[model samples]
Target: SAEGEELLRKLPGYLAQPGVTALVFNFVDQLIHGRSEHAILHEVARDASALRSLTRTWFEESALMRALREAERRSVPVLLTTDHGSIHCNTPATVFAKRDATANLRYKFGEDLRAERPDTALLVDDLPSWGLPQMHLGVRLLLALSDHFFVYPTKLREYQGRYRGAFLHGGVTPEEMIVPVALLTPRSAG
Candidate 1:
């Protein structure tokens, strides 16, 4: 982590060097910690506000910010984008499977699958029209949820307690998918 931070710190210098044309800042789904469900639900949910707080803090302190600031100072162009988004699951969708099943709130993987709500965009059963090749349910759910994922009720308390103080974004909902793209140029020194 320290090394990561150090690398981040050097980003500004890296971009400031020369021959760099454009920089794209794509803060994708749960830009903070989508990799860890437990971390997303537990640590980030503890806070009352949205998880973007953590991202804000990162931008303030991380090398990414430093790089962007340098680019701004130099009058370089920057573009920000996200491939998809995520959602916080307030309603639990029960997925039944045998023991030794892999469990993820956003999606699940197992045999003999069943869900509490049939409305779920089943990957194996649905989404072929979207041109995505057939994959496991988890992968399908992941794609379908694109900016709107699941949040289980079983971990609601834990999520409320732990993730109360972080930033997260993903889900089909507007908040996650509908982000802004900005172009910044340095103010004239005149």
Candidate 2:
């Protein structure tokens, strides 16, 4: 964190003078965006061990973590959580829906939904029973299961080739449904 040491030294000054001290870091967003925009997801998906190492390294080396260490030095408490989890999708299933149907690979909410691989998706008339309050007539919910996710019938091959090894979320897999909660206290806490 030598690169961040200079910035760390300056943080206290800003915090001391600030009327309202607030800091927001988008470190996780940058990683997720890197997965989507870059080929990092595909590169890592096939190698689970490599992916794990990469993630651990990224978190340890991140400036955000450096900042956290600086805060810890000043006896600050930190709460961290994620909105959702992601899965390395393996199962492929094509779902039938209208052209204007919701364009989410993890789930689909549309009318007359049909899946080539029926077991891969959970098709319900509405989303209320699934913990979502929103409901509508003729609107159905199809949540993908396990490593399964939705793919369009048209250009299916192209889509699959592009997304087969990509990590994605918003489905019903355990990885997608479960979230982690972390409360970090200073190591020197008495």
Candidate 3:
């Protein structure tokens, strides 16, 4: 807490000395980790509205916004983005993956990963089209569609229960693939 404040205090000096200074904020990431396997998992997990409320409240009151306000006061530019979008997963698609498979919930990257055609999608033969590099020869990406998530056949019930109703990404959907990018310039600057 105080450490972050100290960083902010030193920010202008850092900006003045160097060619470029980059300040990256991950407010939503902290909220995501707070909700899952980090903090009180049950609170937001049980009540869906808790996620929305927490997000809105944090955006309005968090120091990340305060830092941005300070930047705006100094007439600095603010650009906002998210690493990836997530969707509330419902359906489960059975896939076969090796032990060393890339263990993402919505996608699997491994050899011989298979799922039903209607249930999931398999992208092999090429990765450049998607801008994803294949890990190795014959390596492929198996992606879940719609609200579906990839679950290994082993311990199927356990994995399904663990991921059901959770927000996740790695596959394709309008919400997951499409992201909003905004460059914030204060009206005073204009």
Candidate 4:
């Protein structure tokens, strides 16, 4: 809780130290809150405009922004990226099972389950080719769905409730897999 802020305050000193050549900021799942996770998935699935706003808000006020600013002040080389992206799920294909059911908009899980068109959704069955640059794909997919930070389609309702409404980002897609890396340094040095 408070430790996050405390740690953030000390980051500048940590980066300013000598011998710290490169600083890589990995901000994937932390960008989205637990309550608004599914919102992104719904928005991405049907609305392009919403996605743009979501993306802007994510980069602007997220932890990534805090770290980026600190790194820039210290003139440290920074690379920003993710593991994967997620797809919005509208059609809730029936997944058969005995236990509780998860509430992820992009993906779901249970004991014994099946989907009419599993291919349309990004699941374990489509990891090889669909999952590329592992990191980016993971982040994008998770952020698009629900939060809970990193909740795979394993546990049923418990995890679902924890993540439902939050934004997530892992999975295999262009939005999640293909991320840009920007290098920021002092103007004088540049």
Worst 10 residues of 3 by lDDT: 33-42
Candidate 4: worst 10 consecutive residues by lDDT?
140-149
Please tell me which model should have the higher TM-score, number 2 or number 4.
2
Q: In candidate 4, what are the lDDT values of residues 39-146, reduced to their tens digit?
A: 455545234456557667766875557777777776677654444554332222333333443544444444333443445343442334555344323222222222
Task: Give per-model TM-scores.
Answer: 0.56, 0.78, 0.85, 0.49
* Residue-by-residue lDDT tens digits, candidate 3, 71-153: 68877777776667777777888888678788888887787777855556655547777787656777777777888888777
What lDDT score is found at residue 19 in candidate 2? 61
Model 4 backbone overlap count: 36
Model 1, position 74: C-alpha lDDT score: 62
| Model 4, position 63: C-alpha lDDT score | 59
**lDDT for each candidate structure:** 0.51, 0.73, 0.72, 0.47
Flag clash pairs in model 3.
none
Q: Which candidate tops TM-score?
A: 3
Please write out the lDDT profile of model 2 over residues 23-113, one tens digit for every residue: 5555544555456557755466355566667777887887678777876887666677777887877667999998757988888877888
| Model 1 global lDDT (CA atoms, 0 to 1) | 0.51
**RMSD (Å) per prediction:** 5.9, 4.0, 2.5, 8.5
